[model samples]
Target: MMRFDNIIIGMALSLILCGVTIGAERFPPPDFVETDHVIPSPTVPGPRQDIYEYIDAVVLLAALGLSSYLVLRRRSRRAIFVLMVFSLLYFGFWRKGCVCSVGAVQNIVLSIFDRDYTVPITVAVFFLLPLVFALFFGRVFCAAVCPLGAIQDLVLLRPISVPNWLESGLRLFAYVYLAAAVLFAATGSAFVICRYDPFVAFFRLSGNLNILIIGACLLVISVFIGRPYCRFICPYGVLLRQLSRLSKWRVTITPDECIQCRLCEDSCPFGAIKKPTTDWPTTEYSRSKKRLAILILLLPVLMFLCGWASSGLKTVTSRMHATVRLAERIYLEDTGKVEGTTDASLAFRATGKEQKELYADASNIRAEFKLGGWFFGGFVGLVIGLKLIAVSVWRKRTDYEAGRAGCLACGRCFQYCPKEHERLKKIKEARAKY
Candidate 1:
C-alpha cells in the first residue's frame, strides 16, 4: 500500500511540475518600453486583486486542511513532502510571498492600535488560520503548509544537532523579536519584521543587496542548521509553539506501546524528541525546590531592573519612530546646530507646521515608547523566570515522547519506529490475503 501511494504521489507531482513549466512557457514575459529620464509609477491593484486575495485565503485554508490530514491521519511523510513542494511553488514563488502570516503580525498590531489602519481580510485569515489550527492540531502548518519552513526544509541536507543550552538561548531571540515588532507597530513606527525579513527577497526575486545577501547566508546555514528561521527567528513561530503545547492532538513516535528500542532517539534533526527520565533523589529534589522558591521570590526584582534598564534606552528606541527622528533633525536644522537641512527637514519646513507642535508630537511618541519598553522588558524577565522555574521542576516520562512545545510535527520520526515498520508489514500481508 505504501509503495502504491508513493508511485501515485510521484506521478502526480511530476504532472503538476510539467504543467506549470508548460504554462510558464506559454505566457512569455511582457515587454516594457522605457522612456528617457522617466520614473515609472507603482501599479495599483484593482477589484480583481481583492478577489485574488480571497482566493489565496481559501487556498491557504485548503492547504492547511490537507496538511493536517496528511500528518495526523495518513502519517505519510512523502505526502507531506509533496505538499510542501506545492506550497513552496504556489505560496512562495507564484504569489511572491505577499500576505504572509509572519509579516501579518505587524499588520494586526497596527490595525488594533491605529484606528485608521485597516487590515485586509486575507491578511487577517493568514494571521489567524495557522494559530487556530495549532490550537487543535499542533504545528501541522509548520510541517508542510508554511512556505518559509518548506523552503528551508527542502535545503536541509546535513542537520547538526545544536546543544540544548545553546538552542534554548538562541530561541530567546524569537521572543525578543516578537516583542520589538509589536512595540514598533503599535507606536506607529516602522515594521521592523517586514523590513528585515531575509527570505522575502528570494520569494520576490528582487530586493536590496544587503537583504539578498542575508537570504543567501541563511540558505547556506540551512544546509546544516535545519530551519534556522523557524527555530530561532520567526515571530509567528513563538505563538505557534505556545499554542501547540495545549493542542488536543499531537504526533506520536509510535502508533502503539513503546518497546524501549530507542530507534527514534536520533531521528529528529531539530532535537525535539525527549527521552525517558528517572525520578530524582529526595535530596536533589529538595535542593531544586529551594532554588525554585528563591527564583520565584527574585522574579519581581528582575522585572523592575529589566524595566528600568529598558526605560533608560528610550532615546534609542524612540528613534524607531519617524516623527521623533524628524523632530530631532528639524530642531538641529532650526537652531543652527547642524550644517544644512535634510530632505525631511525641508519637507517639514515646507509644510508650515510649527516646530513646537512637532516637538509635542515627538514627545508623546517617546512617552509611548517608554511605557512599551517597560512592558517589553517585563515580558522578557517573565520568560526568563519561567524558564528557570521550568528547569528546576521535573516531569515524569516512562517512554519516548515528542516535546509538546518544541515539536514541529514534521513526521520524520515515524519512519524510525520498528513498530511502524511492523504495522506496515502487517498491512501488506492483509492486502495480499485479500
Candidate 2:
C-alpha cells in the first residue's frame, strides 16, 4: 500500500508539472494590439461541449457506483485508490473542473430562484447524483470520486491529527460557506464558490494568480493536513456530511467482531473513528445535563442576535452586486464626490437609464440581501447551538466505530484489522478447496 501510494504521488506530481509546462506554453504573454472600433464576436459552443457534459454526468454516476462497491462490498483500498486516480484524470484534468458538483450547487440554486434561468439536465445530474448516493452509501464520492478530494488525498505525506475542539470549530466554516454560497446564488449576486475554488486552478492549470497562490498554499498544507479544503472549506462537503450521517450502508473497520487490538484506532488521518466510551460519572453527567439545558435556552437568543447583526450588514454585503456597485459609483460621480466616470458609469449614462430607476433596482437588491442575511445568520447560529449541544451530550459505546458523518470511507482501517486479514485468508483458503 505504501509503495502504491508513492507511485501514485509520483505520477500526480509528474502530471502537475506537465500540465504547468503545457499551460505556460499554451498561454504565452498577451500581445496588446492597439486598434479602434474592435468588434466583439460572441462564441457559441458546438455539439461536442454539450455531449461532453452528458458524458461527464454519466461517468460521475458510474464512478460513484464503483466507489460504493469498493468501499462497502469489495473492501479494497487499492481499488478505491485506482478510482481516485481515474477521477482526477477524467473530472479534474479532462473536464477542467467545470460542470462540477461544487459549482453546480450555484446553478441549481439559481435555477430554482430565478425563473428565467434554466439548469441543464447534465448539471442537475452532476449536482444530485452524488447526494443520492451519499444518502445510501455514505461518502463514497468523497472517498474516491471527488477530484478535489483525490488531489489532496494523494498529496498527504505526513498528516498530523487536528485537535478535536479545533477540528469542530473549523468545520463550522463549511456550513457558513454553504450558507453564503446559497445566499449569493439564490439572490443572483454571484457564484462565490466557483470563483474562489482553489483546486480549480490546479485542475485548469490557469487562473488568477492570487487563486493559484492560494491553491499552492492549500496543497502545501495538505502535505501535513489531510484534506484541509474538504474538511474545513468545501460547501459541497457540508451537504455530503449531513447525508452520510443518515446513510443506510457504511464502511466498517472489521469484517467480524472487533478484537480490541487498537491497531485501527490511529489508522485514520481524518479523526473519523470514535473510541469506545464508558458511562459518565454521576457528577459529570449532572453538570452536562444542566449545560445542555442552558444551551437549549440560549439557542433562540443566539439566532435572533445573529440575524439582527447580519441584517445590519446589508449595505456592505449588497455591494457584491454589480448594479449596487455601479449605482454607488454613479451616485458618487453625480454628487461630485469623485472626479472621473468609469466605463460602467459611462455605459449606463449612454443607455439613458434613469438614475431613479437604477437607485430603485439597487434598493430592491439590498432588500433581498437583508432578507437573505437574516436566514443565513440564523442558519449559522442554529448550527453553532446544535454543535454546542452535541458536545455537552455524551453517549455510551461498547466498541470503536467509524463516525457516520465524519468518515470518508477510505478503507484505511481495514488493513489495520487482523480480523479482516483472517477473514480474507479463510476466504482464499476456501476458494482453493473449492
Candidate 3:
C-alpha cells in the first residue's frame, strides 16, 4: 500500500507537472518570469502576508512558541495542543514552502547569484530568532519552532543510539560545513548554507530533483534514527547546541526525585539521558583532568587566532572551484563535444562579448561563497561563544535540555510519553479492580 506521503507526493507532482505544461503552453518563459514590480501581486484573504507562505512560517513558530510557553509555565492548554498538531501539518507541509527557513536558505543563495537581490526578511528571521530565544529561553527554539526538525521528531518510532564517538564525529561535519559556508558567504561568493540545504525542497514542495531526493533520505532516516539531520548535519543545530550549553535553565533529571527508578532515562527516545556513572568520583575527576589538560594546551593558540582567523580567509576557494566547473562545462558544450549534442546547443554558442561577460561573471561565484561561509561561521561562533561564557558563570546544566539545538516542536511527546502511558495503564488497572 502506498504511504499517505507517497500518495500526497504523487498527486502533488502530477498537479505541478500538469500546471507547468499548461503554463508553458500558455504563458511562455518570458511571461512566467516577473519583470516589473507591478503592484506586488494581490493576496487573498486569510493570515497577513502571502497566505501559504505566512501560514507555514507562522504555524511552526506559533506552535513552538506557545507549546513551549505552556509546558514551561506548567499549564496544559489542550486546545492549543491540538492546534499545534493541525497547524504543523496544515501550515508547515501541506501549504507548501514559502518563507520556511529551509527555503529561505535558497533565497540567500539566489541573492549571491543576482547582485540586485536584497536580503530577505525570512532568511534573517531564521538565522536570528533562535539566537534571541537562546539568550533568554534556552533553546526553546529547538523545542518547537523548526519545521524540518519537527517533522523528523514526529516520525521517530524506534531509535537506536549510535556510539558517542560516532555521534560526535558526525557532529563535527556540521561545524566544518558551517565554517565552509561562513567562509563562502563572507567572501561574497554565495550562500552555501542555502544551496545544499537538505530540507528546502520539502519545504518548498518544489526544488531541484537532487534536493528532493536528499529530503526523502532525511525523512527515511528520521523514522529509524530520530532526527539525524538535526543531531548530525544541521549547521543551525550547531549554533543552538552552543547556546544551550550556557542556557540558564536546562531540562534536568531533577535531583529531588522520589526514586532513581531510571524511568525517565528509558522514556527518553533521543538518548538525552545519562545515568550517573557507577564510578562517579573517578569518572568526574578523570574527565575534569582531561578537559583541563586539553584547555591548557589549546587555549593560548585559540586566543591568538580566534579573532583574526574567524574573520579572514581572503582567498576564495569553494567559489573558485564552482567557477572552474561551470567554465569547463560551458567550454565542453560549446565545442560540440557534449554528448547527445543537438540543436539545443545553439543558444550557448559563445560570442566574444558573451565570453567576456561570463569571465566577469566569475565574481558571482566568489560572492556566493563569501556570503554562505561568513554567515554560517560568525553566526555559529557568536552563539556558541555566548553559551560558553554563560556556562562559565552558571555551572548548571542538563543533558535533557533538548540536545543543545534539537527540539523540533513536534507533539510527539504528547503521543509517546512513557510516563503518561504508564499512568494511563495504572488508572485502567485500578478501574478494573474497583
Best of the candidates, lDDT: 2
RMSD to the hidden true structure, all candidates:
16.6, 14.6, 13.1
Q: What 10-residue stretch in candidate 2 is worst by lDDT? A: 21-30
In angstroms, give how far residue 359 of model 1 lies from its true place: 0.7
Q: Once superposed on the true structure, which residue ranges of model 2 sit more than 4 Å away at CA? A: 1-47
Cα deviation at 73, candidate 3, in Å, is 2.4
Summed backbone clashes in each candidate are: 0, 0, 30
Estimate, for each residue in 13-45, the C-alpha lDDT of model 3 and write its tens digit.
Answer: 876877764334543335334566444558777
TM-score of 2: 0.89
Leading candidate by TM-score: 2
Query: What would the TM-scores of all predictions be?
Result: 0.88, 0.89, 0.60
Please identify model 1 stretches exceeding 4 Å from their true place: 1-48
lDDT of 3 at 30: 52
Ranking by TM-score: 2, 1, 3
Q: Give one digit per residue, the lDDT tens place, for model 1 in 18-63.
A: 7764334544545657734555689986555578889999999999
